[model samples]
Target: MTSSRLAHEHDEHVCPRFHRAIELVGKRWNGAVIRALMDRPRRFGEILEAVPDLHDRLLSERLKELESEQIVQRRVYPETPVRIEYALTQRGRDLERILAEVERWAHRWLPQPSKS
Candidate 1:
């Protein structure tokens, strides 16, 4: 189907604010990062490994954006070398319920084909 047609289909099922929320979460690699963080805080290298396809520049930019929006918190430790980690803030934790629901929908409707 066309992009506009698919969008219209979504509009019929979602309100404007919820659609915008989905848009924010659906940005490139944003959802993947959020899903990764759902388990626990991760170091930058850990996150990079979890999202193997993510470019360092794009990942860094997305992390900073999420930090500015208060969705994620970045902690840096001072030492011989710097230690940094990213964890979800309370607001980000609130997204767990919504993300779970989306996960369920995806599992139900987007299942992968079984290998022969």
Candidate 2:
């Protein structure tokens, strides 16, 4: 088989899945949110705090998106304050290893800015 034909076949098989997964998880705040939930469940405020500089509105939207994607699960406690907690679903937990690998790659290839 020709190399160009193999390349084309591989792209046809892999590109859509790769692009779709990246498009979902690579959205702003999505990765950070996932990272925050990796340790344990968190309240909305905690997620915001875990992810530095994330806006309240953006965090809300991202959480909703992740929930819809089945990556994040939302639970509400019945109480006076009606606390809401977000946790990673099994699907989301599966990404932890992937994220760690990405982190390793970034540490190796990406240059860090000097702390001035």
Best model number under lDDT: 2
Stretches of candidate 1 above 4 Å error? Answer: 1-16, 113-116
Clashes of 1: 0
Error of 2 at 89 (Å): 0.5
Note the clash tally of each candidate: 0, 0
Q: Local distance difference test, per candidate? A: 0.88, 0.92
How does model 2 fare in lDDT?
0.92
* Candidate 2: count of backbone clashes, pairs at least 3 residues apart or interchain: 0
Best by TM-score: 2
RMSD (Cα, Å) of model 1: 7.1
On residues 36-56, what C-alpha lDDT tens digit does candidate 1 reach at each position? 898999998889899867988
